[model samples]
Target: MGRKAKYSYEFKLRCVKQVLNHHQTVEAVSELNGCHHTTLHDWIRFYEKYGKKALLPRKNKVYSLPFKIKVLEAIEEDSLSFSQACLKFNIPTKSVIMNWQKTYKKSGIKGLNNKSRGKPKSMQFKRAKKKSSKPLTREEELLLENESLRAELDLLKKLQALIQEEQSKKRKP
Candidate 1:
């Protein structure tokens, strides 16, 4: 699911109308609405270029590598500003294009490839048990038994220490 917008479409349209139709200045409208002037200006521009649809919340789009390259090329070839590039390409925000430019500069075309978000499938909290067809030797079995015994001893020691601490605290107060 897409994230909810900070400003509703109606709110943006009202702000934009205050600036465009009411002859109010962008800074004045934005200041009154408690949003940045630049943000209000972008809204005005988007409204002008794409109408009310531009004010609606947009779904997160996964741009293909080729499409990213194309957008980057257009930005470079046309010397378009981030805002202009976003408006031209119908991208949701200028920061998205800015990040693309930074990634392209830092890692080249390979960086433009879409990466999976969130934890990878390979990550696991609990390790999988090893499976082997061969039986364990006597020495290996003895080593495993010793390890388990040591772990149990450590856990018992901790529990004993915690109990003693509680008893001492109770005696103190």
Candidate 2:
């Protein structure tokens, strides 16, 4: 397995202090900490230059759909290509352009707007699954009753046919 990433804020400060204040060489601190000399040098530079922002973890920067649409509009207005847009906006990828173009072509403005774009959480489905569902309409109940009566009548006709067949056989014998 790869070695875990080491990120000790206090340790970074100590290393930076040793390099800056004690006249310790980056190579010496690197050797003592089991890190690369270049890595130690970079840390020292980062501490000296950016202070704390260089050490703090960066949050994921997400652009909303509307924001993305605006970006695309700006790219179109500037007549910039995908690569140019990526460079101009400092975006990490080209898929952003492709996706925005697709949405713009499909929906004009509304497609780019934020909306719940999938099957809604089914309140109707939940109601249907309840132990006591809403009562059927009178027409629906009447139709069901008619169907049951029809089935009972058909069963009675079959019993009558069987009885007639048995009687006819007895008469023949």
Candidate 3:
């Protein structure tokens, strides 16, 4: 599928201004600007309610735990399906709510917290710890990491020298 269409802030502002200040109907302005009726309607609603701040496009959405629980509870108590809840609450997708439900079931409310989704950055490679060994102290770990990096650099230098020696031997022959 093609990438989703993105509208710029200036474009949105100009379109919204045409409808708000110029006394033009949404339908007429939308037709003139080649925007759909529903998109224009949503823009008008954002402009009316939250002013211009709401008009800017947002990439990241951080939903509160309470909101997630409330939505799930509403679905349960009201006997509404995922699609129904999504439409009623103006949510983008059902999978988001479903994932939240799964996390809630596995780890209760704590799983809903926003955390980094990948491995932490460290020079030391991550390996499985032996059950009998205690965890290394921070300073000791840093020393080990330094030694590992130094060894890696030394090995690379040796390989480079060996490659140059081989090239020289080939040229001479």
Prediction 3 global C-alpha lDDT: 0.80
lDDT for model 1, please: 0.91
Model 3, 42-159: lDDT tens digits are: 7776667667876776655778778888998999999998766765665645788899889989998899887775678778877975665778899988998999999999999999
Tens-place lDDT per residue, model 2, 96-168, is 6787789889988777766654578767543443444878889988987999999999999999999999999
List where candidate 1 sits over 4 angstroms from the true fold.
122-173
Clashing pairs in 2: none
> Tens digits of per-residue lDDT for model 1 on 97-126?
999999999999989899989777885588
Clashing pairs in 1: none
Scored against the true structure, residue 41 in model 1 reaches a CA lDDT of: 85
The local distance difference test score of each candidate is: 0.91, 0.72, 0.80
Displacement of the residue 85 alpha carbon in candidate 1, Å: 0.4
**Per-prediction tally of clashes:** 0, 0, 0
Off by over 4 Å in 3: 1-5, 71-173
RMSD of each candidate relative to the true structure: 5.1, 16.4, 9.5
